[model samples]
Target: MTQQDVVSTGSTTEGRAPKGKALAATERIQAPVGGPGRGPMGGGMVGQKAMTFGPSARRLVAQMRPDRGKAVAVVVLGVISVALMSVGPRILGQATDLVFSGLFSRTIPAGVTQEQAVEGLRRQGDGNLADMLASMDHVVPGQGVDFDAVRNVLLVVLAIYAGAALLGWLQGFVLNTVVQNTVYRMREEVEAKINRLPLGYFDRSPRGELLSRVTNDIDNVSQTLQQTMSQLMTSLMTVVAVLAMMIWISPLLALIALVSVPISLLVTRAIMKRSQGMFVAQWRRTGRLNAHIEETFSGHSLVKVFGRQHEVEETFAEENDELYRVSFGAQFVSGLIMPSMMFVGNLNYVVIAVVGGLRVASGSLSLGEVQAFIQYTRQFTQPLTTVASMMNLLQSGVASAERVFELLDAEEEPVDAPATSAPAVRRGEVAFEDVAFRYDEDQPLIDDLSLVARPGQTVAIVGPTGAGKTTLVNLVMRFYDVDAGRITLDGVDITAMPRSALRGQIGMVLQDTWLFEGTIRDNIAYGRPDATEEQVLEAARATFVDRFVHSLPDGYDTVIDEEGSNLSAGERQLVTIARAFLTDPALLILDEATSSVDTRTELLLQHAMAALRTDRTSFVIAHRLSTIRDADLILVMEHGAIVEQGTHDQLLHAEGTYARLYNAQFAQAVA
Candidate 1:
């Protein structure tokens, strides 16, 4: 979970969305996949498991294919490093033999030759001692250890080890570079993928869970590669190099060590099989816990208002406990590997020692060779153990990679239309020709809807909640495409025009205002980024934003806090209106734009909007019937169809859906 707390940045909707559409972000309504208590952003349902292990593991490896050159460099360095280190034990063994030979020379008593003394001892019935002495090379009868020779061999061993250490460090550096660079590109791809995804994808997926995939999962992948790859390469190489040395020293000892390989593999494979699912569950639970926490903090006020804090706490405890349980299980299962491998290694050690001793007693192998062989035995078994222990990291990384891959592979919005298809000139005349749409195939929202908003006209839309008020404006913006019919601007089909070009000519102010963490001037200029100071002030005044802004200490220069918590609801709405006004769009869309402000401010905004709507086509979705009293034409929608269309007075005279809605509101106001 993230340490930084962030307020939820979403707006309010007066009505719920149609089926197949995501519920307003603020609602706890359950979708098919993510139910209530799943938290906002819709975390994965309980008992959901990760993807198959093999394919995910393969895909992760494919990600590293681009870094093959650096990987090869690491491998080459590891091989050279291991080779050099492998030679050190043998050289040290030479030093040991020299010391043993010098100590034995004094006990031999000056003789014709060392061979003659060994033969005399053998004839005197001391066969075992004679045999041991026979294994020593170049031992003069009365000479002590040659300190100078021993020092030379010891220096060679030190030099070999130092060279090996240098190469090992170099290998690690290159491997780290490869892992970091690969992860960097992976992060870039994921970020780009997020932009390409459709709005609905976000509706279904939890924000916290998606964030976990993008941030925590990718970071884990990086750490896993960094921790395991270099060591894995070096350990495997050490095993190969040390095994070769062992075989050369004594085939019998080498064979004995090989006995542990199959046993170790069986143990590793068995434990990995059992632990993989636990790791998957561990990460899944982590995402759920994060989502719960995000929802709890983002909607903290509502929780307190309804006295749901205790319930929220209980939910959090449940998810947190689940995460803990799975995490502990994964760790406990994978942790058994090192000790088990160590036990097997110890048994092999005992067998090799006994066999090597017997060979030395019979003079089949010299004592120094036996000592070097014992060291090689440790070198071989140690790398095997190291490789076995890396399984835990490997499984965890692949699990994260699967989650990230799922995001990268999500369906994206269709590509934009060609620029050549764009209209030569954009006029504010919008027509819906026999349009039909459904959020879900079985449940239609709008059907055979046809209407036209002529240039310089204000078309007021009033309806009950879920009357497709926002959906109508959303269609104009092409936030979604129609299922059967085409919408046109200036007689040019909107689908033919590039979406960007079509949307650029339109300005929208939603009921739920959005303001970023920047100065008021910046937020107002968001719709037209290159707007001049004069243009900004002009737009602000026209939207009544300047009236309150100038009263503040910094005026337009005042910076909004995160999610604009520092601004009042009306102030934030006015800022958004000014942003839309600055664009000077050919068309305008307002969804209860004046809902957040008081009556006085609403009257001022009405006048401002009236002026701005001159010579511009505007679509106004209103819940307050009183607000549309002076509108040139009023469209009363019911069940996604326009049930009444005319001036406001005509609609009331008709005594249909519009009159009932208006009278109800009037009566409620009086009450």
Candidate 2:
């Protein structure tokens, strides 16, 4: 095929395009079974990809069991900080009262006896306590009171506040440590799950969506929780403590102080009620933006080839605008909470002063008492405002909590087998016994499928679009359980065995080969890390990967970029094939084994597959018939059922569906 004949990704050459043709035309197309790009359907299931947050986040934490101590320490620090803040105002008030008594001189008022003056001092102390406390706060000057003593008391108050502040800062530090730990642990878990999850999982979820959940969404929650533990919780404690003080000092004034609280709280609640939904939306848009970016970059080459850069940019702009709109709404509403609280607080202060002043002037209250009342009122309200502001953090934390919980609670693949025993083994053979599967329960893609690959023989599975060829391989690996039937290896059910054990002895190579960011030597030794260097090179040479590796800039030491994008598709395939060859498994499954490469690369892969399949149980799923002509058996699948089965020559002689497909493809190659 020349450049002119390079068709767009989903355009049909001769047959009808599968469903999702509309979405495919919009941007880069993903696997058919996976939903949109490679979605929940990519595994050819009706189930959406497991992209929820809660179960996933919990699992992330579970992965870092060692960090559990740090998480607990952080919470402890947070509680202590709250406790200190709650008691701070009262401690300062008590110290101020002591200084007031010491500074006024308890002797008689100029010639009165010491005993009478002591009695008078006791009387005046009540009258002076509020002013004394205010003076200690540096909010007023002491009259007939010792300035030195007041200074000493003020110093003590400062010490108390300083301790509270220190605890507050420490709480912040510990909370951040926990946040980072959670994120680190969660990220590790996501990576591990991604590695272990079946290929069908990737097929269903778009790479961008998963990336968003793992990276951005988790960050939002972590940041929110960090703030909640430090600032929000502390502020809430302070408000409660101050209110308790006011109510104790004088219930009347305390009642007046609280008049504005309900109004303020109402406004705060309304704002948050509106803001929380916006926040969730904003985060979702953030995920979509990430998904957009991933999609654009992943298919940059295709976009350039098709000259659709403008379309790409326009689509990106739309997603960006939506994100901006939602973000602005969320932040704007959350930001309003503080200023509104302050306004309501000031109003409450005015009412407290008016009511308290009348009582004081009427001699029902002492100056010190009134002053203390005012200070306590402000203290209570200040925390109320603070806690209100912190509500944003709380809502955010909860949202993240919800997301994290979703991931942590996700349906994990079963680990135990059913009570029933598997089929008795007659030979080291594998068979798909009436298997049917869908990623989701709603859609069934493969129905009543059955095939057999006898031990020491190679089998080929072939089909057109959505023919369930790859899904068959997934079942054999138990990457996914069949919805209807059971698959057996050596006549023993695959599902009955441990997945690790079942998959441990199986090797596979896919069309879009993936190589992690590592040295070429390491990539080949991935599954079998214990393999020797000699074994590594031998496998590489056997698969023809050594021919190219030696020619690279740094030979085997050269590092591959993400997904081996730096290498050509053929080179990537060669590396993956070599890795598979190194494993030397009992059963080998290759899906679209050589679909992406040129004729030369195809020939190399064909030679490599031939060597790899010798004396081993093998199954090859392919659209390219030429690569599998030598297979001992060929099974043709359609809509989840085995429609035809035979050898290459036998299928040709039978004049059935396989023969028609073979003839058509062969004629096309000749043409």
Candidate 3:
């Protein structure tokens, strides 16, 4: 066929124009199956429900097991700090007692002894003052406020507080290190897990949702740990230390303060139970919203071309509103914890004050002790309030943790056979033996399929969409393993070899051209990172990428944007072709490799591909029959079964599936 015979209109061999209504449907971003509004799950069931709080919280803590030593240090330093701080209130009480005694004792006439002043007060019928003096310790009669002793006691109190502050800072520093290290390890695990997962996982999951798990969720976990871990530990410790001080000062008042513990706990537990599910919902909706945005932006041009901006905006608003609803519910429910705990704490405070004041007046406890007990009450109540308030952070963090953990727990690709290696000699022969496979068990696809492509043979596969065309290539690449039978490379089972080793021998250029953000040279050399400049240039020239590179301002050094929008479709396709060519693989797979280029560029790419196929087994899937007319063998597939197989002329003569397809394209071309 002449070039003119193959170049009539922008249409595929499937008898459809490239920019027809079918393209519009294919271009619009469809939501994933389990995406927003479908159910409680997000990212293909990454979050099935709000995981049980206990287990999720425990698992999060388990991640920090490796940092146990640092955690222990944090605990120890916290205890020491709380201990030093606890002593400050008692010392302050001592200073207060000293000043009070000296002032009252000085009110007694000068040179009067302490017993005489007290006896005189009692004789004057001032029994209340006498009782207060009796309750006070270390009071010297006729001594004015001893500024020297008070100064000494205040100095001691300041030093204790200063030391406690220093230790607290150190504890926080150590705790920060632990939290950061734990989060770092978790991020590394998530990164590694992504590589271990099978292709099917990604096929079902939305990209934006998965990204939220890897990025936003993990970040939330880190922030939660940073905010809560230290505070929780210190708060609990303060409660204990303060409780002990309270009991030492007055058991009755201590019992009154203890009344709030159960009430605070009950309030926190109830609020947490209600908000846990909301937090999970909040993050799940967040992932869904993110997926929607990512898909819309990725297909922004398609959306605009089809004038679907309003539709995209509507979908985004719906998901955004859903996210806002869940977020508000989670926050509002968790926010109730603080006020409820505070109310209980304040009630306990009133009771403690009433009981302690009466006890002080009854001469059962010193004024100084009452002062210390009140301070202890505040310390105790404050920590309880803190722990309760942090329920918000705790719930949010654990919810995010569950999402990330779900990803970590996803099914991974089967491990390769132990001690396996690729076949020797790299003969480039591939064979499928009655392979049976299906994405869904109930929906059979590619059943009992068998075929072989000998070394150096160019096998072209033509099939309609959903005809298992891509599945065949995927099986060959071991992206998904066959459910039955086996595929072999050079007479050895491909599964017996490691995926990396098997893939290293095969080079593929798909229908979509992917170019990362890098220079033209870098994109071309992506398949062979160690390729020398000379080798890269040779590949570029062979694939005709040099044709356009020379015209650019930076030649091969011109950078491609993230979307590769800087280059035209044809240019990007040529760069990808060059990328595959640079690999010099033992086998090649081209899936509509020339679909994006114009007739002229497609013809040039055909020649470049012909050269690239030399001495290498090649599997070419194309919708354009003209591009594969010279293929050594052409297999016509429909519904996962090959209906015809022969050279172009033989298949045309047979007047079957291939003939009808070829005739239709010919008719269109002639018209």
TM-score of each: 0.91, 0.80, 0.93
Q: Which pairs clash in model 1? A: 41-206
Higher-TM-score candidate of 2 and 3: 3
Could you report the Cα RMSD, in angstroms, for every candidate shown?
4.3, 7.6, 6.4
Candidate 2 global lDDT:
0.67
Score candidate 3 by TM-score against the native: 0.93
Off by over 4 Å in 3: 1-47, 120-126
Give the Å shift of residue 222 in candidate 3: 1.3
Please provide, for model 1 over 1-671, each residue's C-alpha lDDT reduced to its tens digit, 9 standing for 90 to 100. Answer: 00011111132223543334543232222344434233332234323446777988778767878889988898889989999999999889899889988998888777558789889989999998789888888698987789999999999999999999999999999989988988999999998888766555555456677788888999999988889888888888899999999998888889999999999999988998999999988888887777777777877888888888888888888899989999999989998988999999999999999999898888888878999999998999999898878888888988888778877766566787776555566669999999998777888889999999888889999888877877887677766678878898988888877666777888777776778788999888877778899999999988888888878879899999757887777778777777878888899888888887899778887877776677799998888888888888899888889888999889889998888999998987798
Cα lDDT tens digits, model 3, 1-671, are 11111101111212210111111111122334533222222223233645699999999999999999999999999999999998899889988888888877777777777777778889999887777777777677666788898899999999999999999999999999999999999999998888887655555566788899999999999999999999999999999999889888888889889988988888899999999999999998998888778777776777788888888788788989999999999999999999999899888888888888888777788778889999999999999999989999999999999988887876677888864555568899999899998765666777888889999999999977767776788788877788899999999898888777778788887777767788999888777779999999999998889899989989999988856888888888788788888888888988888886789888888988887899999999998999999999999988778889999999999999999999887897798
Stretches of candidate 1 exceeding 4 Å from the true structure: 1-49
Ranking by lDDT, best first? 3, 1, 2
Local error of candidate 3 at residue 470 (angstroms): 0.7
Q: After best superposition, candidate 2 residue 390: deviation in angstroms?
A: 2.2
- Which candidate has the highest lDDT of all? 3
Stronger candidate by TM-score (1 vs 2): 1
Lowest lDDT 10-mer window, candidate 1? 1-10
Residue 221 in model 2: lDDT: 64
Kindly indicate the candidate among 1 and 3 with the higher lDDT: 3
